[model samples]
Target: MEQQRSFGSHTTGTLYLVPTPIGNLGDMTIRAIEILKTVDLIAAEDTRHTQMLLNHFEIKTKTISFHEHNTQMRIPELLAKLANGETIAQVSDAGMPSISDPGKELVRAAIDAGVPVVPLPGANAATTALIASGLPPQPFLFYGFLPRKAGEKNRELEKLAHESATLLFYESPHRVGKTLAAMQTAFGDRQAALARELTKKFETFIRGSLSALQTYAAGDLKGEFVIMVEGAADKPAVDVTVPLKMQVEAIVATGAKPNAAIKLVAKQNGLAKQVVYDAYHELEK
Candidate 1:
């Protein structure tokens, strides 16, 4: 009988980070199945959830809970298996692990211990929302979640409002309206996309300015939401590619005030305040 060998014996056991489907089961890959089935053990964010997945595929591989709450405690046990030449796999309830979910801690520990980590990428809400956003895409920042504190979230929003690229965030159903309102306050007048329930039957995407988004969600908004805020609107003669200082100089030359120039420059460049501020200051010297 061929003992199910996963990682190379010469090297420490490889950690397979598998990504599951967001909504549909058909999204699971053949390669991901092979890795999951063959591993010595599996670390799941939710054991009961993963048990259903395993039963569907008839994969009886052993699994243990490895989530944010228990991940720290379970690290040594998982590492010991890897140290003893047994491979391990980690999966979330949906999508990939370590993205606003648990498993990041284990990944960090594995790297620090010189264990090889292999990624089996598949579905991610951030990427899905960006593709369907219909906004000026690329060069976007992926904020896994806004800060829980209202003040912290606002400060972060204020910082990103100036960037020329799109701003993407993952928000839950309960806080969608609050997040939309916060963005409206910090970002102001910007066109945005509230893509909710991605890949699900009732998936809906709302496109408009921040105010429009708040109003749209004000009524019966349900399920998860992917908020995509468009970068600053196009401006006149303000090149977005140049260094912040040079760009600011060109705009300010056209009789634009420093504060207005700074604000507009950040928007035009789709850059943060610090990046734009340094450039504005350099141009003044």
Candidate 2:
């Protein structure tokens, strides 16, 4: 357990996590601008991108690159600078730092080293879309980008199929159609909403069944999407009367490969893949 007073005076310099506007520059907060101007150094996901933001606000603070690839080289240097009482502000290309972005590691290292870390509340695409989505907002699970591989993505969706809370996901325009289709297959045609080009002039929201969203996504794929899916109703009990091996075989008869069938049956029956695989192959022994 660790205690931290964000504003308390400390021997080391504080790390301020500042959020930038996602689309509209006007969304940038006054305090965030002030922090960016005052910090001794700004750790940015992309210095070029951040330079534009700094130029917009006329902020002259120097920035250093701190992204996924260079975290190993940057974290130590940033920590050492903090230890020398040189304040630093970490910002992503847009929105809050560390939300499906870089900065988490630096924040963790700073906390472990007894450096004060302060966060400023600001725009977030997830909450921005959730409140506007015609779905229940109290209980929500913000699952950022899903796994890219089909098998891994499918397994992940299977795990969330029975969650009662509203599910949020981020997807690139090119893959939104495929993702919506997968969600429909895993969770059925539940009501859902898609927000894109948020805060920009073309900002739009499409609300309907998952199938409808999939159809819409097939057309002009544009900005990044925030997908809000309604939570599942109480899950129906799986039938245990049929032997697991037989269940896998039935799916295989539908033209699915043997391994694919095993995975599907396991997910549908809430069993592990290895367990289902063993049961399906036990008859061959």
Candidate 3:
């Protein structure tokens, strides 16, 4: 009875969210390796691909597939194991999982189901690109990747135009040309950088205006890309005497994103936002 009761208490497993190397296998961390070894099972986005990585490091831990395609079905089973005291670790094909990789849904599900999720920060392409970008890092948004369609891509870039943060994105070599062009159109003459093939022998970082990057990609597009674009230049105080609401309404009328449009128009008009606010208040009334 004592042995059975002791064994029965083995329940609820902790989940670990592991970050793998984006390029070089040698970048894998010792803690990550130890966690992977200790976990009861490893839920990998691509088992075969991770096998190569594990084989490189001589990590003999068990790996199972739990990618986007099968995650819907596998998540429930994973949760069941977790509830039964089986520790599971998740890994993506490369870089961090769920940032354009699998494992995000599982992480959320695990959280909702009361499973403990331990995040082991290691290698991430977004930060890698941002650091190499040489752009001011403050107030930057990591967009991951834009939609493939030209119209949607442009729309997304338009939304980011007035963000005033260094913008970051991941891009494939094949699509880098078109992405640069769309960025040029949406961002206009903004400063930008293209960090490509990061942490690899051919790692390259191209810093210039978005227009310049477009031309570079036209001739020398190779390797994956992480593009970082400087936000729109801040408005000088040439204008600022209006109430905020009027500015908001004025920009909303021009089909600009209400928030960005308002701020830009306020700066352009050289009026205090109070005046714009009064005008907008009247309009509301």
Best by lDDT, which number? 2
> Which 10-residue window of candidate 2 scores lowest in summed lDDT?
251-260
Q: What is the C-alpha lDDT of each candidate?
A: 0.81, 0.90, 0.79
Q: Give the TM-score of candidate 2.
A: 0.85
As a TM-score, model 3 comes out at: 0.80
lDDT-based ranking, best first?
2, 1, 3
Clashes per candidate (backbone, < 3 Å): 5, 0, 24
lDDT of 3 by residue, 6-48 (tens): 1223446888889999898788999999988888999998899
What's the distance in Å from true for residue 244, model 3?
A: 19
Off by over 4 Å in 2: 236-285
Q: What lDDT tens digits, residue by residue, belong to model 1 across residues 1-285?
A: 223244555468889999988877788899999999999999998899999998988899999999888876899999888877788999998898898888888888888877878889798988888888898678888887999889899878867766778888999888888998877666556788988878889888889877777787778768888899888555466554577777666655644445556776776666776678876676453
> What does candidate 2's lDDT look like per residue over 166-259, in tens digits?
9999999998999988887677678999999999999999999998888898898889899999997764456899999988787666444567
Best by TM-score: 2
Instruction: Show where candidate 3 strays beyond 4 Å.
Output: 1-11, 238-285
lDDT for predicted candidate 3 compared with the true structure: 0.79
Q: Could you tell me the lDDT of residue 87 within candidate 2?
A: 97
How many times do residue backbones clash in model 1?
5
